[model samples]
Target: MGRKTEQTMRTYHRYLGFFLAGIMAMYAISGIVLIFRNTDYLKKDVQVEKKLEPQLTVANLGKAIHKKNLKVEKEEGGLIYFETGTYNTITGEAQYLEKRLPLILDKMTKIHKANSDHPLFFLNIFFGLSLLFFVVSAFWMFRPNTPIFKKGLYFTLGGVLLTLILLFV
Candidate 1:
């Protein structure tokens, strides 16, 4: 590309990189946190209580309480007991303990999960498009004839290859 195009691309790349630095760091941290989701790596249990529909059946009770397995340790005197807590079969008062990530990390991790209904959905779209722009603009950071540009191409190829291997293998 011409000098003007290269300079323009570099300007956009540099300024946009600076502007998105904080969000990028958050995305990175959230991604790392998600890797440990299968376990309670950074989570805590909190007591939860909810009043559900009364007189629910054994099956419906689990659905209402939003628990899997729904094992009834014992039911006595219109109450059902389970691993986490107990439930009132007559009045539908359920108490349980739920594990949750802390507030700040929870909110951070939610950014990637934002759907069309979320306000951050627009931010997701904008960040994604800006990332595409960054990829294209990176080529303009150095002239194609330069040694560093050639080395960058090699590194880019290695990165793409490593990603593909990790994705499919």
Candidate 2:
């Protein structure tokens, strides 16, 4: 690469690293938290009360409250008892205990899981491109003939190999 290109890459890489440090940390922390999603790690149950449409059936109640596997255990005097809590058919009140992470952690996880349909998808794409830029810019940090550059290549190969092994084995 030309000296000018190398210099530009190095400058941009350093600045971008600084700019993206907070987001990168968020991704790292959220990724680690997501690995424990199946477990109840860092989750707390809190009682939640919501006002839904009145006189909803058991099937409609589940859809209204955004609970998928909601089963009505029993009914007594227009009130229905489910797994987490109870709902009154006569009134538009639904009381439930939901287990969730703290607000900030939950938001981080949501951002981590953002899909094409989500507003955060644009941020995800930008972050992905920034990471790709970092990977490419790294090559321009040092000349290919240098010992440090050669060692970096070896480390890169090791990372690729480790990723493949984890993926397939």
Candidate 3:
């Protein structure tokens, strides 16, 4: 390869790596957190209690649970739960705990969970392509005949084989 082309490839790989490092770290952390999604590790619990004076209609019961004013979407059981509502029913005192994620990371986490139509989805796809570039660029980082390059090739092949086996099996 010519000196200028090789140098340009190196610069492209280097700058892309630098640009993506922080976002990569964010993905790694959030991905780990998502793997344990059902757990309470990242959520803070807030206990809420409300008093009711009404004679406990299903709609009223649901409103109490939701702690907001909401239209009764559907009613099941003798109790009522609206999409969002606040109500007072004669059940001694109704209380529940609300789980809330931390503010800033929560926004990032939402973006991470976004679907294809979401604005962040394009950014996510770009990030994934950047990762693919990082992996491919790694090969050009070294000359083909170099020992390091050969070892890296073997490792990459092994990784691909392992993934294929896992997928098929």
Best by lDDT: 2
**Residue 120 shift from truth in candidate 3, angstroms:** 3.0
Evaluated against the true structure, the overall lDDT of model 1 is: 0.91
**Per-residue lDDT of candidate 3, residues 1-169 (tens digit):** 6667667778899999899889988888777777776777888977676776556765455554654444555444434444433333435354556666787667767777988988769998899899888777777788787899899989999999999999999
Output the better candidate (1/3) by lDDT: 1
Candidate 3 lDDT score at position 84: 35
Across 30-128, the per-residue lDDT of candidate 1 in tens digits comes to: 999999988999999999999998888778988887777788899899988888998897888999998789998999998867889997699999999
Backbone collision count in every prediction? Answer: 0, 0, 7
Give the C-alpha miss distance for residue 6 in model 3, angstroms: 2.8
lDDT, candidate 3, equals: 0.71
lDDT of each: 0.91, 0.94, 0.71
lDDT per residue for candidate 2 within 19-52, as digits (tens), equals: 9999999999999999999888999998999998
* Candidate 1 residue pairs in backbone clash: none
